[model samples]
Target: MTFGEKLQKLRKEAGLSQEEFADQMGVSRQAVSKWERDSGYPETEKIIRMGRIFHVTLDYLLNEGEGQSEDLAEGKNEEKGMYVSRETADGFLAFRQRKSLRTGLAWGLISGGLCLSIWWTEPGMILYLVLMIVSVVLLFSVKLADNPYRRIEKEPLVFDEQVKADLNAAFSERKKTAYLLRLTGIVLIAAGILICPLITTWVPLVDDIIFAAGLAAAGVGIFLCIYMTGILRAYRLLMRQETE
Candidate 1:
């Protein structure tokens, strides 16, 4: 047995065609084919990546024989259905953080602009509208950070044990933060809704202004709740995959 043979076996066991495997590893099908044919060797980085993808160690990939091959074969028969990658988990974490920041900023800007627009004359309203447009543009920027891996949506490749533990810890902390954001948003929205009817009774002279302020708070709160929930759901899916 050889490294090429092991790679071929692992790829087959994973139920991926050469093309699909190459796509996952960010390589060409021809490159994978060449490796499997023993005509070319993968670079060190690729070798490491292959180790991760196949859930094997460097030694396992480097040393090969019938015994080791048979061991892997038996392992595969157990049919571990899916996997997750440390790289993918980290990437998802960063993406979610960036997106969360942008979402918060956008919501704050738009809501503030809306509140101001409510009180402004024509020219002032135009300025507030511009501010709101800027907020919308910020929201669009979320697409700028494109995900490079398939693991965020689907199951991920196998990660080293330590890497898996770290990812889980990080995700747990993030989940807590997400929950806090959700709670705060809910409280803000509840307060805003409750304050709406009270504005007239509490301060009749500035009823319209107070009402508009409440509306703005509620709008911001709604955006926060929606955005945070989306982030939480994505993390939850990954956690579920880890368990599976």
Candidate 2:
């Protein structure tokens, strides 16, 4: 008998329907159906699991049948668990890398533009307005970008230990840079807060040029912090800490 036929016979003898068998195997019912119909075969791991369920040896289930032992391990069918492939993981990282820059810039522009527009420069206000509009649009676009891994959000992801290790290493590589940018951002913000007020207190007059310049510097610092954080968040998503 073929592997599927043998599987069907074993499941029937055990008084299990396709759905029950699928549940026992930690797979979808359709996956069980495909197996029984010989349209698909389970992975080598799944085959081993099934052997245990039926109280049969791997040699017995796979014995001398069409030279199929090697072919059976090719997991062409999707399992119940979200088994994330390396390619998918890489694609997601690339997508996030591309999107996060735009996202960070958008937030930076919004904050900086609003702060710089405080002094109400006539022609400069026009420039800030354009930036603000563009920032808002970019933010929305990032939010609505097409995401292929959306379903992964609903389930716990399963991946090879190597994928996990690689992600951890990548995050480690990025953490130092992100930390520096965040520290710099804190310094710049502090300067922005104190730069104008300190001068104003001494002179009893404030310079719009100085205040706007300080806020603008703070904005560039904000951009760096946001950009670095956004990149790290992508690593977190793949690591399965939390979803987006």
Residues 167-232 of candidate 1 have per-residue lDDT tens digits of 678778877887898888887777777867475656554886777777677777877786787777
List, residue by residue over 1-244, the lDDT tens digit for candidate 2.
7778888887897667786567556678899999888899789988866764565667657764655534444332223344555555776677777787887788778767766566566877888889989998998898888765554455556665776678789889888888888789777777876765455534322565567667776777778777777777877776763222
Q: Residue 80 error for model 1, in Å?
A: 4.4
Clashing pairs for predicted structure model 1, backbone only: 83-156
RMSD of 2: 9.5
Cα RMSD to the true fold for all candidates = 5.4, 9.5
TM-score of each: 0.65, 0.61
Model 1 residue runs over 4 Å out of place are 1-49, 55-60, 63-85, 107-112, 143-145, 201-205
